[model samples]
Target: MTEPNSKDPAPSPLGRRERLLLAAIAAALGLLLFQLRGGLQPQAPLEQMARRSLELPVALANGRPTILEFYADWCAVCRSMAPAVEAIETKHRGALDVVLLNVDNPRWAAEIERYDVNGIPQLEFFDREGQSVGRSLGGRSLAELDAIATALIAGKPLPRLAGVGSLSQLDVASTPVAGPRSHG
Candidate 1:
């Protein structure tokens, strides 16, 4: 064939439709990668369970109550507990120790198994010697968490059924009321 005319438009690159389709596929792949990366990455700092070393036991041995929370990245209850746990951290700063352990991490997986964490939002209270004094599993409301913290600080036994109750089953009667109700 005759040499391509110099002025001829370079063989049409990808057509508009082809370009659009390629772009769409690229965008879809990008979105998929982003989602996969997010899922694989650790949870956000505020949302992540705190990690502590064995030194935690030494701190507990100093006669302070320690709150140890075991959580996973995909757990909705764990995410819900984030704010309350932070509030507890702030409220009991220096008085009560708080530690978060990510069960997804292999380093703490043994502890997770040892503690028998079958669900998200596993809360364990440790005495001065690092012994587990009490534990509550599943979701907990702010008030219930506060009560548990208070009990830990006071060296009193945490109510067995207090924070472990299902949210669907929680009712006005289940909550602890401080003031007398007015029937009038």
Candidate 2:
């Protein structure tokens, strides 16, 4: 047997082939983890709708009935109702327009005020003429949304729903009746 040289450096515990194999394993694990993470947390339906929703102005002016939803990302009701909204949008595509506006975003501040959105999940229903006919506050079930969509597509009156209110014109243009003024 040959004696070890005192001045020589010790050999590496891992050979080049072993090191390469370890690197490959680590890379595979990293890739798998990344893929798993992505697969585990898919994008929510609300996010997809928000990304694909038509702009408010365009939707209202397109001559199609519009369903404008005001929501926040953190609102539980909005999240829960997103799937139904998405379904309605899909079912009424080309005949009706569905628009989603995030209330938390400052870009929609004007719309929020115009629609008197005091709560999340406020839905404003507009006719084909771009006139707002009604609004609904709070979350709605799939059946309710579908019914509303059907009415809009058929050019009929929206179904009476809980938390829903009509936007009708007042008699503001009529001449005032004679009345005694009290200045006391």
Candidate 3:
């Protein structure tokens, strides 16, 4: 204590072990925050199905029954139905094909028009021979979806459900109804 040596440094309040512990805690908190910020979170069901979906052309030509879902990222009904669609896809991975087309994506504009997608989440069901069998025009419960999938897989008629209808081509002349407000 003889006037402490000039070269001596002051001791840190925290010991080396304490500092290490603090650093570890800080790192853990940072990681947790990153996860909370969605950096490490699992993908949403819609995104997961989209990522795993096969192309429309490929799915159509694969000699398997196919389900085409027209959806948009911002569509709440579509998001709500994503989990059921995903489950159907997973459950019929080999026997059937599930394809997702985002309505917001310009690449699917032709399909959007082809399918007459005035509203979503529209689902078009195709048979093994790639023929359009039926279409569902709105969100459906899991049981309804599963029933549809099961019928399609078994080559049976789709279950009779609201918003569900068989698809077919018709040859007829059409004319727009003339009205004061009609643009056609």
Candidate 4:
């Protein structure tokens, strides 16, 4: 048998063409997985939204107030409000309805319109009958949110902070109002 020549360069561990193709395939798979992850994750279904009108209404109508949080993944305000909302949900567990609505879903456009939501982090309070009783917009502290919930439960108007606007003012047209409305 002829000995291999040491002067000849050894073959690459992987051919250049093969390496490029493998990299391309890997990149494609990575993108596919990134796109599919959201769908694969456990999320509230679109169909369940209709039930919000029915089930949530009934729950609210039965003397159990419901807290509806309209949020979007891209919204900083929504992300900031998440923990406070979670805390409120935990505090009032069996007594109130705490639901999160992803406003990014086109299916929720109608509900968004119905609620006249113009921004992220919209919190709506509904009576057991599903009638909207109160609303608060923007990020709030747990104490601030709890106070709103408390006022709703007691049928009292939300205490107005010196600079903060009322929930009604959070609507699309009213958002231009200047200054912070107090929730205390």
Candidate 5:
């Protein structure tokens, strides 16, 4: 090291106060990134959605349009799509009946077979005449659910869904659909 030259103007190392300010700025950035992580992923349960379990034959016999929601308690897609489904129910109120069928529950085993419910979050629609309208599998956006419910109430053609297969009145004669992964 050379002798100290107090008169010479040179860049000095960061003082303790400066170091602390940098650390605080870095910590704030870290916190911001952490918050952004949550914003990046698909968020579920938009609101506390209200749904009710149902008995298939009885619910269908009520002489109203029915939407059978096949789900399992452990299913993430079911949990997430819940608020949207509830919105449909709230939208259609008296004219439509929303049925919650827990696939894991033995009570709904027969319904599971009748609908060939291999995937969770399946939204099955039935017209007032007790005819099958269509069924949507996997995750569905709020708009999709809204469309289906609106169409169902108006007796219009149900919107076709992608990623997961859907069954319409015209396609009921086709073969059944098998295993499909659920969403979160």
Candidate 6:
């Protein structure tokens, strides 16, 4: 047989252009898949639970009104009330400070006592002057919490929170001990 003509080619698995196109397709598909996978993932909970909260010292010295919330991971009431409280925190933003104290942590034992927090989901309201304006307990609705905060901010009597365990001003003379150390 004669030598192969220039136009005649030996069998090859892939031509250079074919391989390059294949690689480009693979790269594009990989990127598309990556983007799709990322988009499918769920977003982290936001404004449904307190994310960043004030520490005890900052809250004590904030000069702004505060809501000291005692909660624990296992407390059902605390869990149920988280969303409502979170909404309140978001709505009030800079006008108010919400401090979260995990009762499960020993660091807040002093605060647990100071607020007379025998049960969870307790709220202790402190005014700009660091005075204990009032304390409320149990799973309060968003409306109730909002009303309470508004009243506290306005220095008005708290709107009646029916079924709330306690909602009354603290005795100025009977000051709570130095606030608990924060885990924030």
Instruction: Put down candidate 4 lDDT per residue, 1-184, tens digits, no spaces.
Output: 9999999998889989999999999999988887776545524332233234334445656777788877765566666566667677678767776777666555455677888787667778876566777677777777888887787666677766343322222234432222254121
Error of 3 at 7 (Å): 26
Where does model 5 exceed 4 Å of error?
Answer: 1-54, 165-184
Model 5: lDDT to the true structure:
0.69
Q: Rank the candidates by TM-score, best first.
A: 2, 3, 6, 1, 5, 4
Q: Provide the global lDDT of candidate 6 against the true structure.
A: 0.71
Q: Against the hidden reference, what TM-scores do the models get?
A: 0.60, 0.69, 0.68, 0.58, 0.59, 0.62
**lDDT ranking of the models:** 2, 3, 6, 5, 1, 4
Q: Where is the poorest 10-residue window by lDDT in model 2?
A: 166-175
After aligning candidate 4 to the native by TM-score, how far in Å is the CA of 134 from where it should be? 2.1
lDDT of 1 by residue, 59-125 (tens): 5687778888776556667777778887887797767888887655555545666787666677788
Q: State the RMSD for candidate 4.
A: 11.2
Whole-model lDDT, model 4: 0.64
Error of 6 at 107 (Å): 0.8
Count of steric clashes across candidates, in order: 1, 0, 0, 12, 0, 0
**Model 1: how far residue 183 lies from native, Å:** 59
lDDT of 1 at 16: 92
Model 2 lDDT per residue over 1-184, tens place:
9998899989889999999999999999998988876656654567668779888889989999999988766677888888889889888899999999876555666676677777767889999999998888888999999999999888999999865432222222231232454111
List runs of model 4 lying over 4 Å from the truth: 1-55, 162-184
Model 6, 113-158: lDDT tens digits are 6777666677888888788877877778888889988877777776
Whole-model Cα lDDT per candidate? 0.68, 0.79, 0.79, 0.64, 0.69, 0.71
Candidate 5: deviation at residue 163, Å? 2.7
Model 2 residue 25 lDDT? 100
